[model samples]
Target: MLPASASQLLNPTDVGREFLRLLPIALFVIVFGIAFGLASVQAGLTDWQAILMSVTVFAGASQFATLELWGQHVSLLPLVAVVFAINARHILMGAALYPMLRELPAGRRYGILFLLTDANWAVASQDYQNGRQNLSVILGGGLVLWLAWVAGTVFGVTFGGLVANPEQYGLDMVLGCFLLSMVLGGKRSPRVLLIWTVAGLSAVAAYWWLPPHTHVIVGALAGGVLGYCWKERRHGG
Candidate 1:
């Protein structure tokens, strides 16, 4: 039998409420997006190209990584590798949502994955942990965040020089800080702490020894594997 949390239907009203709840955070995302726009232009991407990239590929970290690789003679292999490695965390995030997602039809299930991002996923996961079914946040919150990102890119393209260096104002750390806040808000057990520790050390090791841009995925996978094992052991599965 499915879990009670998994049986809850997607609520449109809840989705709208989630959208409003996430608006404040989306404001910060806009600022971060502006930084990306400026960096994209500095990397020689045309304004349209930058805007389009932001629209299609809403993954900020990977987009920034690509800026370093952008040039007249861009190599395909390294570009693909870095983007895939950095964005691979979505794989785990999507997997984590499967319990809830499976309740929906296959089309709606996969469709929601397109809107998956760190912020919305964090909200949804936290709700699930508390035995709440709140998939609406994934849809509504993701929409707002995606729109904010695109809007920010447009602003940056138009006024790329306004914030010449976003880092000076610490805009670069916005997303990181936000994610950290979300993590701290969640339940923190001994097992969770150990899993995070393993993930962090694995990330550091990968950053030093593995290829560039691989640390993020390596850390995520390490944490995920540990978490999965703990779950299995707890259930005696």
Candidate 2:
């Protein structure tokens, strides 16, 4: 009951290409997740909680933020709001990736968007641009990130007591290092630096001016607006 064109569209080679492309990002995420798990556990999250969050949510930033907010004794509504706002970027991410997913089955597209994150988006974007929009690649990449996140969190929770001054030892700084290394190793672009700088400043400003998760929305909107405005102007729109 499958259309000939549809079957032809979903090529096996595309899956292989996606696998190759996601390998580096997968490694980075594994390492980063382990560090994050260690930080979270030392910060007071139990082993099961950290592991569960990793396996279920698989979002390191939101997970860390939740731990931070929980430590401050913030109420549930505010906590949820912050998590939602911080994750709002995924809406835009899903939109950007929608075109590629359209080439696949509806359920597949939905699943991909639901589980996709910054790291997965980066890999998928590259493949899409390269004309290798393979669904299998996306699945493989997402799985790697998910597993790394869970495994790292479990390891951290188990070994947290052994690590001393984790925050001071720069375990907390691994996210920055991971991102920085990714950029430095890639093409140097002024626009990229501009977006990053704007986003960082906005995050700081939001932290100062807004309530818990409000800053997350504000920072994201501020950075996104800055990036969009610049792109529009560049295109003479």
Best TM-score among the predictions, by candidate number: 1
Say which candidate scores most in lDDT. 1
Report the lDDT of model 2 for residue 174. 54
The TM-score that candidate 2 achieves is 0.68
Off by over 4 Å in 2: 1-17, 39-44, 71-74, 127-137, 161-237
**Candidate 1, poorest ten consecutive residues by summed lDDT:** 1-10
Model 1 local distance difference test score:
0.86
Instruction: For residue 150, give model 2's deviation from the true position in Å.
Output: 0.7
For each candidate, what TM-score against the reference? 0.90, 0.68
- Report the lDDT tens digits of candidate 1 across residue range 89-203: 8988888888888888787788877889999999898888777777889988999999999999999988867767777888777778878887777778888889989999999
Candidate 2 lDDT score at position 162: 50
Residue pairs with clashing backbones, model 1:
none
